[model samples]
Target: MLRPQGAASKKVSVPPALKSSRGVKSWKEAAAWLRARGIEDIECITPDLAGVARGKMMPSSKFTSNTSLALPSALYRHTISGDYPDETESFRYEARDSDLKLEPDLSTLSVVPWETDPTAQVICDVVDTDGESVPYAPRNVLKNIVALYAERGWKPVVAPEIEFYLVAMNDDPDYPLRPPKGRSGRSILGGQSYSIAGINEFDELIDDIYHFSEKQGLEIDTLIHEEGPAQLEINLRHGDPVALADQVFLFKRTIREAALKHGIYATFMAKPMQRQPGSAMHIHQSVIDEATGKNIFSNADGTPSQEFFHFIGGMQKYVPSSLVMLAPYVNSYRRLTPDMACPVNNAWGYDNRTTAFRVPLSDPQARRVENRLPSSDANPYLALASSLAAGYLGIKKEIEPTEPTAETANEGSIDLPRGLLEAVALLEGEPDFLEVFGKEFIGIYAGVKRGEFETFMQVISPWEREFLLLNV
Candidate 1:
């Protein structure tokens, strides 16, 4: 079945990239850069939520193979339940049950600019042996949602502002785990928000991340030092919905990899510390109709107030049930308290940050609603999908949101259950969403998340022992 060495077979143009499918770099030019730099261990990585690799590591010899390889189902930080439906208990993977293949989405291939030695990484899409997408994969979920918008002659653009902290990576037997301080106490630089000099002082590391992102072909919108100390967020420009989701996935992976290479562990955990600002993945949303090239979220009357209010109403109506999607973890709800400006109530205001739903009323054409309930840890695809599902429900029903007062989201509860079970219970109580997103999906999501809660609860926490050891 092989063509002769010089068969003169016709060639097809596959753009300038993917012409040859063998190597860390999609282009021969990139491969040359690697050979010159003595780069090896061309790692093929898939990001899992629990911080594990679900793909294979390529040996230096076979780095130039022209065929794709198969891997177990990929992973991410938010699969709150069981492993991929088929993974066996043996290796925590069952290749036999796997109908999935890791197709190299060559567009994501990049050289790790931060490492001293040359290293290249590529993002792969998880596909079945029949070449169909695996439905449960996070990437596939986002891809499907994005496709829905395209099918409807509309495009949804998203930009997630990530927030997180940096803590010690080294072991200290005497000291508990905490962020490294001025030299020891886990304290961070104070009162320097938006200061150019502060950013300049750490220019080396900041610039490194920028360059790394650039090498990966991520559109760097802007990088800034957020309000909280040691809190940094890199902003990527919005693109096509599917591509934007890919970019977000890649962005998170790149940050994690680059930080680890520097021996500083970075966390995307919703709340790593009690006193600090919990990490949030606040999504700024807007939609455009492809046929007329007009933004659907914009009000044609040159006043977006009405459009903004409708979107706000959509969020307010579905947020209670949508909590399962937005805040998927126990730690996620810790950020929902009023003290953190976490939008404890489901109120919307013109250009306000205090409510769960905020209409950023800047320019009429550019106005959009900011959904603030999601944590940095929630799956962007499912969160966005749930939001879109809810928004569509709002539009269909011509929703008029109830007034937001003390009872909007129940401001009285001292300690709201952050557990997935409770969140799923609220979601189940709302039947309004079933007619749109379907009862099957809601049931599946609820079942999965609840299973995760059971699995997590089975494990004994060190905190339990610290207080109980002496007393017992």
Candidate 2:
């Protein structure tokens, strides 16, 4: 059992900002900051393709800027099931299986609030021996897209709305998960969208979430109950793409740890239960002029700008091809079905939830498009990169979007790929995404997904055994 410790579990008069090591630029400064906090261990980690934390844990005293930490280069080619793709022309295994160096990104350094021992964790960048970034690394792929915006003197700002479920613990893989009983000793029966009572049922766990987030320097915009039983949504404040992605990555870990402390499991699965609404990572995105610091989506007259429409045009044109990244898993397609509060078409509209892209009603400075297609299960880094890459392409090509559909987009024919294999094929054929995200990454990523899909095919579900055994 994990016990809460450190300043997070206890009251401290010192503000989190003063205690945080986020601003430190060098290892010497980071060491000073950790020492001040009496940190005993440091977790040097990086997000893999599936957003899984991978790297080394070491004593703080041994964690220097020059610490030679490295992971197998083939780690990037690993499937979520921990199996590597069969060697093929698309994904050839390196005979040497070289190592990729891990360099800490000091800005992400934060205290492990729930740890029994005083510990710190920092996100790392994967680099080769030459000190150049590994192109396929999830973080590096995002950096590549962000660099394109920087070259055009534009800064992309994004805020993600993450939705998840709190479910009862299930040790067996065959059994379906159910909502956990709250403080009232009863399980949630029906939808409780925005119900204060629903949130209060798990008040203690929610409080721990806030406490853990505060200690990690993550800014929470809001927390609200969603339509599903025990379903909750968290909105993060708008910020830089990489920074926000980092928060989303860490926030997942924080929420799961906090839930476990309460004897429940917090799942980010796109579709965790049957007949329940699927969870989504709705990303609200906009680009700003770096020089004027003005939202490029709105013109000087505060009216919608051409760039805004083109951005939507980009999404409409390219997002289908990028769906593999946004909806990465076989289960992810289960959530993309129509009339489930999930968008099946890449339609754009004004304050319309049915459309894939909704332009929310706000002041010109805050004008942005909310991409509703990404599943909660997606890797934050890759999701952001794919979404931004689509918009970048739209702007670069001046692609024009279709007329905004005020009617229900879910009523229309499904425009998205219906399965993982189909999505992979679409992504492989699209040259625009290939150029933006790199051909090497697309190849390895597609190959890994194909392997996972093959594995899934080998498994016989209960549905097949129950019905097919007697009928078919």
Candidate 3:
């Protein structure tokens, strides 16, 4: 099967100064480091509400930290379809469509491994002209939630298990997606969960994924075949919430580039195919007290702590309202169907996969909750923010969770919103989310989703044509 290529395959040589985990702290350091690598271009980018990279690319020679790069503040207001919602009284755009400054986060600088030219990409922070952070920006939204934890003398650690599918390249949107042909020259037909041979089918692409990740300093704890045809999952090692979110953001682009090189499409759609299993980005999260440097979920005697139950209580209480962020698109709800290995309700259990919140068996130090609600299609930054925000609220409010179930939680009443519009409404109605995510962000986010849902309702589906055409 696939073997690790170790040091020999890690071809990118990072400069000693740039090798620091804290990254290049200043513009001068960034410039010197880029020059040492003979970089030609620099991509200054930031994640928008939809997690789509939006920014400008410039020659490395011209990219100084003092670069006055800015994009329209309205970028965050656009939906997945690139349509902006009609301005409402509370959420009207600035009269001039004012520009927001792009402040490069020097720590996120990394090489664009697949580029023909020696180009580097850095994630930027969206700031107002006054240099204050844009509260609604996806990255900033995540940072705000992290900052809230820090204010409480706690730090949240998150490890995300991202699932996606490899599908054959299709140019037409009307056609159904098909499993890509592997090295065996045949398309995958059945589920191949944890099959070594199944993973071997696309050994070349997996190798490239590893190499691309290595070039960018992204870590992959494990990669395995999932239950659907050509579906795969990558588990990232747990660390800081922001750092892990950044890795997940970049990893999605890396996987897509690697798959394109192999003449296939790597899709993160929640449910790309009707019959196949849907993809999920399950987040394993735990909080540690900054003073004690120990997991807050466990007590001194290694028993489950009150904070742990409160966190779960928070998830159950707030996850439904936060579904707008975790499941943003109209198609995301397709993956939450019952009996599909997906949890339909917000139930918690020990080592249970069917529950929305699963507490895996582990040591006291490693004790964490796995939030199985987020779809693979979610923006990584918002997903982490929403999950952590709920838990933070739980700890603050001291909410008590329901009894953990040992049996299937899918059979329980569906505690989640069934559609994008419903989710948007729930999120809008929740005052706590408005406070946590900010009223401006919720307004923009809900407006965008409403616009997208309206656009979706305008289209006619094949199912409608086939069933209602004659019957009606």
Q: Write the per-residue lDDT of candidate 2 for residues 1-472, one digit (tens) a residue.
A: 5666653565667544446646476666787788788989999999999999999999998896467999998898888998888977777776799989999998888999999999999999999999998999999999999999999999999999999999999999799999999999999866799999999999999999999999888889999999999999999999999999999999999999999999999999999998899999999999999999999999999999999999999999999998999999999999999969899999999999999999999999999999999999999999999999999999999999999999888996899999999999999999877679887898889999998898899889888999999996
288-333 in candidate 3: lDDT tens per residue? 9999999999999999999999999999999998998999899999
Q: Rank the candidates by lDDT, best first.
A: 2, 3, 1
- Each prediction's TM-score versus the true structure: 0.77, 0.96, 0.96
Alpha-carbon RMSD of each model: 7.9, 5.8, 5.5
Q: Give the poorly placed runs of model 3, Cα more than 4 Å off.
A: 1-15, 18-22
Worst 10 residues of 2 by lDDT: 14-23
lDDT of 1 at 270: 80
lDDT of 1 by residue, 389-436 (tens): 666556556787765433334355533345668888888778886664
Cα TM-score of candidate 3: 0.96
In terms of lDDT, the poorest run of 10 residues in model 3 is 14-23
Our tally of clashes for model 2 stands at 0
Cα displacement (angstroms), candidate 2, residue 75, comes to 0.9
- In order, what lDDT does every prediction score? 0.63, 0.93, 0.92
Model 3 alpha-carbon miss at residue 9, Å: 29
